[model samples]
Target: MRHTGADARTTLQKGFHEPVEKPKRFYKTVETTPVDGGFGVLLDGRNLRTPGGVRLVLPTAALAEEIAGEWRAQGETIEMADMHATRLANTATGAVPNSREATAGQVMDYAASDLLLYFAEEPQALVERQTEQWGAVLLRAEEEARLSFVRAAGIIHQRQPEESLERVRQIALGLDDFGLAGLAFGAALFGSSILAIAVQRSWITAEQAFELSRLDEAFQQEQWGVDAEAAERTDRLRSEAAALERWFKALRT
Candidate 1:
């Protein structure tokens, strides 16, 4: 009988599967308060947006600028025509996008999130990539959902619709919690999409996402000699993200 070491290890590794819970980290839930009878970002009882109504959450300057740049190059607001999964502000549910490119705010939000998170976790030297991506649009369209929530909230406060059906669109704290869980579980294998949504939606910190990504990359690199730990971690994180997406999907279904 010939036995390979790999087979033995595989069998042994499966034996360690225990009924344990995963730890949740990288979040600091402040609080929520009502603004004009709607939800507002809060730190305990204080309103995040006050006086002028700008969000109190830390803004990612590079992100906001990149989206603005795209608009400048295009001569007007822009949006993807074939954005299948990219749910824009009103496009997702069949409403005009503020008489603009029809539905680009969310796209900008998605792209901005990409810039913010990349710069956030990235070293200062390599953080200038947004300048190059200004005229380019290369991101998963589905991620625009994050921006939808942010914009929806702003619009909610502004319009104060009699019905306010848009409230149904709000992503709950649980989704944020789930996204964070998935990121930590990946421990570096976390996808940019998840992190992008988080920051754009103002859930987790960009610094945390960047740091986790670096650690995950480092962990995987260390295993290159004999194993693909990074790949393994990524696979697991993918599963988690899929689960979070599923939860959200189920609600819509």
Candidate 2:
């Protein structure tokens, strides 16, 4: 007899005999080749295309190989979410090309509420941790981007200097579409334009940038027990950070 949806799930959870759906193996092999301007990926001997149906021609051969490697690493079921490198390349090649200015503007907008600009209050330890970890990154931004960011002692809102904002905007405008995409990812992941710029400039590695971003949360987690939901969110952010790091490394090669 057939069971209801919940009943079937309960039965499966109870370890009753049931057939499990196996993952589908879509492609047998993946390869890469040099295209006219960049490189493309071939899945089972046919060139792969983006979701938008455009031929996936990445700007660098290294990037192409990274994307191809993602495809080749797929298990029986091809999970698009697992293909972070390919998705990032698709954004760089397709999305960013048509919206470079907008993307740069988005990254620049993060400067308004950049994580480094906000500070914790009360506890001296947390405050000092923020100062020690985030302050150095801010100094690096001032030196590298020539943009001086104002800091707040607490949650009070503060307006950054107009000239500083414009200077930061100009720096963002200077980056190419590929660079802008990576910067946007890094900035959004860490919620700090300064950390993102530092990552782009090699002032700090992605792992260090993440650790800096989560300093306050890490402090609180140590004081209190960890929350499963918060841990999951941190894991996802770390994964995104690593993906952006790989993309940037590919661009450098």
Candidate 3:
């Protein structure tokens, strides 16, 4: 779909506006306590709830502590936008459970036309660069998924194999709610399901994924000078990608 930095940045930043009336922090101590599922963050001995008003329970104590760290880091005013772990935890406990199938469907849809599958027809350098950087990731995906993907040049809309798409679907369907949230977030952030899976599996670092996802723009920037606005947008996406990587790491603990 030719998703540039601007496109993915817009997706990540969508509906992420800071509250006009920021609430002052009213809690003294931030902690985690065992809950029904795993652990829940406690603010001054009171249970913390998601924005949707659901009890914020996590699958692991480590993840719960991570969320608690966010709350502890807040200043006098709570900035929800800065609480990536808490926001993601909210999605995991609140929205993702109810929309698991729809989330998996979205992942499959992105896999159908994943950015890694597309190549530039012209500019031998860009084409070669795409092949060199993207080929290994696609190969690894095929090996792991036991399915082959169709490659397209110049964005002519080449269809990936149904079996391949189904394989990706199964991969997405197998994740727990928290993993699913990370996968869905990464897929949207990178605009490539393959890249998202690669990062989630530790096959590639988030920095590498970000670079690969923006290869086209990087090459263009190399040719025609970098744009300040575009660079700023990509910088924000880079930070968010790093935060997602940390979240995945915390999920392992």
Q: Pick the lDDT winner.
A: 3
In the range 177-204, model 1's lDDT, one tens digit per residue, is 2232222222222333334345434444
lDDT-superior candidate, 2 or 3:
3
- Residue 90 error for model 1, in Å? 32
Query: What does the lDDT read for residue 98 in candidate 3?
Result: 92
Q: Indicate the worst ten consecutive residues by lDDT in candidate 3.
A: 1-10
Q: In candidate 3, what are the lDDT values of residues 186-231, reduced to their tens digit? A: 8888888899999989999888998999998899899999888778
lDDT tens digits by residue: candidate 2, 99-151: 87788776677777677788888599999888888888888788767889788
Instruction: Arrange candidates by TM-score, descending.
Output: 3, 2, 1
Top of the candidates by TM-score: 3
lDDT of 3: 0.86
- Ranked by lDDT from best down, the candidates are 3, 2, 1
- Candidate 2 lDDT for residue 131: 87
TM-score of 3: 0.93
Candidate 1 TM-score, true structure as reference: 0.25
